[model samples]
Target: MSRKTALLLLPGLAFLLVGFLAPAVAMLLAPPGESAGTVVSRFTEMLTDPYELRIIGRTVLLALIVTVVCVALGLPIAYLLARSTSRWGGVLLAIAIFPLLLSNVVRTFGWLVVLGANGAIGRALTASGLTDDPPQLLYTPLAIVLGLTQLFLPLAVISCYSAVAQIDPGLDDAARGLGAGRARTFWTVVFPLALPGVVVAATLVFAGSVTAYTTPYLLGGSSQRMLATQLFSYASVSVDWSAAAATALIMTILVFLVSGLSSLAARKAATS
Candidate 1:
């Protein structure tokens, strides 16, 4: 509120404006030499085209699935990690988060190997007589979901872990002493307290999955094109700048929209 405080904030505000806001605004309004109306028309066409609609739907559906899976797995793991009494608790957490240190390409390639026709999964299935032939796994939506889930799970865990860690362990014990069972205590006491973190984790995972390029492109291939791959095609292959910019704008809006809803949900949960 003070002049000195305002001055201190000015540099960070200026940096954000220059680095993020300006580019985002420009990309939304104008794509290189294309006018606003051109990009708007492309965006409208993308919404109406059945093929493009499928791409958008697939992107959202997969993102939602990945987000749900990550939260379902991550929350429990994070809670356990936060409450671990073992001396190796830190080691366990390190193992859980280790995947984040690896490149996305490396992790995705690993999936390709495991999910390929002659890959580990297919081989195992065939050897067990589960199928007469290797079921096609790669270049499918399932493969994209699996790869994106693996890629973003650690982020979910880390986000939830910090939140779970902040809650006093005494609260859990007190709830138990008051005759609440483990599940009840978690739902009533721990979860409500941790909803914000869960929302944050979901938002991050959804955003990453939606905008992710390598895993979707490599695993899904041409058959399973999501918005990111579509954007790449417009930008590079077709050289359609307006369409590319429109796709980028849509992805950005999807992320921001989810984030806004998540924030509102978190606040409502807090108030409730």
Candidate 2:
């Protein structure tokens, strides 16, 4: 390799080795002789636990739902931002980005106020006589999904907007000239071109959701335990560092698998 390239890579390599890799290795290594067996046993126990399995499944499900919702809601805004020539476009983009400036705790509390039993939605339902009482809006999977979606929607928007902005306007014009409608052109031309952004956005949201603790904990409640929460339980509450390491490794594997599949899908979409 070139000397300049090697020099450029040194800082990142050093940081990765010292900051992340060393700690990860320490976590995975149990002690001396018992490390291998202890690691295997911890993984086996975690795998066999029905409660843990449910948590894993629910985490994946919620992450997927959040990704989909973010794409659904963010794409149109992205498209508008990509296509707009007006002042309000920048204003709207700023508005969309405003939520991410707040801390996760602040955001979760905001959702709590909006989604609580006495919140606006519940009050509207009651005032309109839609029901006798406010439904359980907090501490549910839907609540977790909502919080996550709101939290990460900006990622999807920014990614998609950048991708959409890169597409040649001539393609859209050509598609339209060929008698394609607006929806048809987007499905055929714009969306396929923007698949890479969607993939990136989805992977980011998925990884974030998998590792997230605060939003899920506060919004979904103590009952809604994801692998992250479970890992915290093992490491902090139970003081089981080995089990926590195993759980962290497993979650890492899950994220890799999902990200790999997403990349594969994006490649296929690009080619086909």
Candidate 3:
């Protein structure tokens, strides 16, 4: 490359080296007396362990649920944002994303208060004759899903909205002009174009949900043991650094796999 081109790339290269690559290398090389083979063996053993397998399954399941819920809740909001001409769209967007500005611990604690027995939801449920007792919503898998869906829905909505907004309104108008109904135009043209965004949002939600620690730890019980929480236990409680490293690697791989699969699906849909 030319000297000017090299100089232009230097800033990005320096940032990657100092901000990302350096820390990653340090993490990979930190532990002493640990061969690469030992790390691989520990990961294999974790796979073979039924409890570990259950944790992995639970983590994936929760992530899937969260992704689905985010998409379901976000699509309508995204559609509205994409269609809106009013300044209210910006206000809605701000409201949707407000939770992200808060610390994760604070957000989790907010949910804790809302879902606890004496909290608003519990009181409302009990008073409304839904149940004789305050529902045990806190420290349940449902609470975890509720909190995560709320937390991640903004990401999905923003992604989908960006994609939808990019689409030409004339396309939808032309479809309707050609006798295509609202539902037909949406499903045939709009949704197909938005598939890429949906895939992106799903991947984001899935990866975030899988690796999330604070929400699940705060809202879930023993039965909701996600892989991240288990990994934390291995590292902090058990002091099994090698195993923790292996688990971290596995989690990273899973995130990559999900992203790759989503990309492949999006490509196929785009082509078809």
Task: Highest lDDT: give the candidate number.
Answer: 1
Q: Candidates 1 and 3: which is better by lDDT?
A: 1
Error of 1 at 172 (Å): 1.1
What are the candidates' C-alpha RMSDs? 1.2, 2.0, 2.1
Q: What is the alpha-carbon lDDT for the whole of candidate 1?
A: 0.95
Q: Give the 10-residue window scoring lowest on summed lDDT in candidate 3.
A: 24-33
lDDT of 1 at 225: 96
What does candidate 1's lDDT look like per residue over 15-98, in tens digits?
A: 999999999889777978999999989888988999989999999999999999999999999999999999999999999999
TM-score of 3: 0.91
The Cα RMSD in angstroms, rounded to one decimal, for candidate 3 relative to the true structure is: 2.1
| lDDT of all predictions | 0.95, 0.86, 0.86
Per-residue C-alpha lDDT of model 2 across residues 79-130, encoded as one tens digit per residue: 8888888879889888878877889889888889989999988999999999
Q: What is the lDDT of candidate 3?
A: 0.86
Among all candidates shown, the one with the greatest TM-score: 1
Which scores higher on TM-score, 1 or 2?
1
Give the per-residue lDDT of model 3 (tens digit) for 30-102.
Answer: 4455666777788899899998888888889889999999998887789878887887878877887787788
